[model samples]
Target chain A: MIKTMKALIQREFWEHRGAFIKAPKIIGIVLLVTTLIAYITIRVTSAKVNGEAILQSGILELKDMSLENLILFWDGMFIGTSTLYFMVLFFVMYFFMLGSLYDDRKDGSILFWKSLPVSDAETVISKILTAILFVPIVYSLIYFVVLILLMIFYSIILLFHGLNPIELVWSPAQFIKGTLVMFSGTLIQAMWALPIYGWLMFCSAWFKKRPFIYSVIIPAIIAFSWYWFKVLTSLQFTNISVFKSPAVYLGHAMFPYSNDYMGFSGIQFNDDSEAQLSEILANLFASVQRMEILYGIIFAGILFSVSIWVRRYRNTT
Target chain B: MTQMITANNLSKSYGKFEALKNINLSIGKGKIVGLIGPNGAGKTTLLKAMLGLTKYTGDLEVMGVNPFKDRAKLMEDICFIADVAVLPKWISVDQVLDFVEQTHPKFSREKAEKFLKKTKLGKKQKVKEMSKGMIVQLHLSIVMAIEAKILVLDEPTLGLDIIYRKDFYDNLLNDYFDHERTIVITTHQVEEVEHILTDLLFIKDGEIVLDSDMEELTNQYFEVMVSNDNYDDAISFKPLSTRKIFGKHVMLFKNVNRGELEALGDVQRPGVADLFVALLREEEQS
Candidate 1:
């Protein structure tokens, strides 16, 4: 089973190299170029002013900032970059999950796949693993590499300005901690979004045409119609609103670190108080509700089973 | 002889239409069985049932496994090329080889690569980048490399030129088929596959009209070509079907003795394509 799943995951990567490899590399290149252009512009502008005085003042200002504030600033930069990465990641995975099964069927390649020794359940599970585990892990690794490249660029700039690169930038403890935090945060976010991925996969397997319509538009319509029906009839059929309840849950789960849920109140970058960064990370991770995670897992499990069932019986031309 | 496939009272339907009606068959190992039928004649339905690609009622087993229930397990010893163009168009040849090698315990990557070396296909060429003929060649190479007990081909040479089609069958017979392997195939070009088939099945309107071994077919059925003067006498034997060719009347007889038919006019064994048409015509008339 592990062997088959591993092969299946490799197959996914082969098919979607553009999304898994090329897109992240392209993003990295674009970011590096933009940073280089900005650095050159800064150097050109700083040369017009007294370069030595400006560099000295910048060094003084960096020295004055507390280590906690520096770590926080870097953390914010990491989070900001990750936010952009996740936004692109979401669309890439969403469309990939939506089209993965449908494209095979449409092109009549599903029959070839079905001829293999692997079961339909195995195939679907491999796809789920690819979306939830492989994509994020690969993306994070590439993002880390890009982050390191950007840091090297920063170190080069600092070296030119007569600042100690090791002292001002490369804090080993913080870097390792931040890397761990990014991976854990991305994984948790994936778990939170499992239901959506499951739904898209189910749609991909089941729908004959236009999986987007069936997955997204149909659900939206059903939810809205249910909402209006409750309002007009004034009868409480079910305690849970089909759409609104999950929508609210998804909103909260997606933005766990939002101020409304987990206000960063305890972590102070004050000169005297040395806030433990681990505590802040723990608090952020804890803000995700246990109940919501449970529900998400249950929902995702059911959808994944349905997707497997669909794959078993779906006949492609 | 070991039975490769057994079906008893196997039937399939779609909505109000029945695609297969109580099919009962047992195909033995080492024989090439050709499934022949017209369009919508349940040939594909039966193949799909056997391959576990479709659900069917009644007892059906492939290599002693209930195919629909344990398709994955059954597929380990069975390989199929449902069509010539079923491989995903985006995958490169090397990737396909890698996947098959990794997933299939019986697949030989070295053999597949060797088979591909004979073709003009490059290892890095994707399916979409190759021509239709090359794709079929690539598919055949991969399929032949798998050490399977049963190999099913459904129109495996569809849309190929004569050279490629002939080459496909040649490779199947020479490189793939052996004493231990059984082959079940369906094709619109009955005559093309007729020479290679040891057993023949004729389906019409979701029912098997005729099922017989090639030797049995030769002994039991004959086509008599009678001139205008002998045509009236030949008609009395109740031929399955009759059609005119040039000035002679050709009548197909299912069970009439060859000696008896020879007394009417020139008699010979009918080709598979001709026999198929005659069987379907007989079924419709009945």
Candidate 2:
């Protein structure tokens, strides 16, 4: 099993490393340069403010001597760049994971893979692991390295400005805390997304032409039609007691238009102080509830199982 | 005794058309079988059905495991090289080799590397960059690296040049093949594969019309050539199919001995192509 997983991981990396390195390099450079320019601009302005504190009422706050402010500034950069980068990475990961199999089947490369001493279950599991774990971990490591450099550079700017570097350094504790929350949250969320990947694999096996479009369009159609019917009936039966019930009220009453499914439990956010470890754990658990990981795993299993059957019984000629 | 592969009453239909009709086949261990048919003869469908690549109402087994039910396990001992160049264009030969090494318990990197060297496929070259012949060689290298007991090659030499085609079979026969391994090759190039095959199975319109051992088949049928002067005399032997060439009649006949054939015309061994043509002609008549 360990050997199988290793092989899967190696193959995923072998097939994808070129795209991986290229995707992050451009994005990384843009973020790195923009961050440096922002730092230099803030430092020059803060120096001027220090010379004329009497003229400036606010006295150029984070632009001057605070490391926490600089860290926030960097986190802001991460929030924008990493999210987009990770999303693209995830999309590409899915494409390659599902598309590799699809292309192999379409062109008959899968025959070679299937003939080996690897099981269909191993193949499916490797794909899921790459999507859920490997891709994200690689991207995260890249982002983390860039983030550390920005943090170090921010501290140096403060030291040169006659401020204590220790006070000016970004709080490692806060970064760690935030990373833990996001990592745990994302992993749990990935389980829910398993069905989508499974559906892709299922599509890989069943459809001979335009699998990408069919996989997305067919499932979307099914889900959309179901949702459409519900909306239609819900509108017709406006007075239905079920719609007004507490479960519905908690789910849709407070944010009828918004898709936020968390159903306001009065959680508030301020900073690292507000995001206590205990509360974050509670939220993580709450976020997990909304994910339905087991159901999604089962769905993934069913789709993958069908794919295996299709693969086994598929026409090779 | 365990047979290498078996398909019991395997029947497949595509909506209204039956692609395979009540096919029952059993290939014992250590035999090299040849599957032959013309276009749309269901040769590929039978191979696919055996691999569980298509759905069919039949009981199929490879080494006692139903390919559909025990696919992953069944695959551990079986390898298939499809007709087309199916290796991923995004992968280099090295990457594909590494992947096989990792995924297959029986995959030998040394074997793959040796085969690659022998086949003249550079490890660094991407599949997309390679020519059609090279792609086939790369595929063969990866497949040959695995220690599988049951190997299926579907038109393995299709579209290949003479040298590559010969090399492909040579590698299969010399490096990969053994008495412990059972191979089934489906091809239109019957003459090329005739020397290597132990048994021949001919499919026509989704049914097996002829399945016979090579020696038995050869002994049962004779190729007879008759001059126009004796063509009328040769007609009485129930020739399977006949054609006129150089003012002489060339015919293939079954259940005809050389001693009996000398009374009318020259007797000789029928080529695999001729044998297949005769079998197909008989199928058409029946």
Q: lDDT value for candidate 2?
A: 0.70
**Estimated TM-score for each candidate:** 0.90, 0.82
- Which window of ten consecutive residues has the lowest lDDT sum in model 2 chain B? B67-76
Residue ranges of candidate 2 with Cα displaced over 4 Å:
A18-26, A37-86, A89-101, A155-165, A171-173, A195-208, A211-286, A289-317, B1-3, B263-265
**Residue-wise C-alpha lDDT for candidate 2, range A245-317, written one tens digit per residue:** 2222233222221123443344444457433443544555664554344666787789878876666455342
Quote the positional error of residue A90 for candidate 2 in Å. Answer: 4.7
Candidate 2 CAPRI classification by DockQ: medium
Backbone clash pairs for candidate 2 read: A312-B52, A312-B53, A313-B52, A313-B53, A313-B54, A314-B53, A314-B54, A315-B53
lDDT at B90, model 1: 93
lDDT of 1 by residue, B192-259 (tens): 99999999988888988888999998899999998899888888898888889999999999788788
DockQ of 2: 0.56
TM-scores for chain B, listed for all candidates: 0.96, 0.95
* Alpha carbon deviation, residue A317, candidate 1 (Å): 5.6
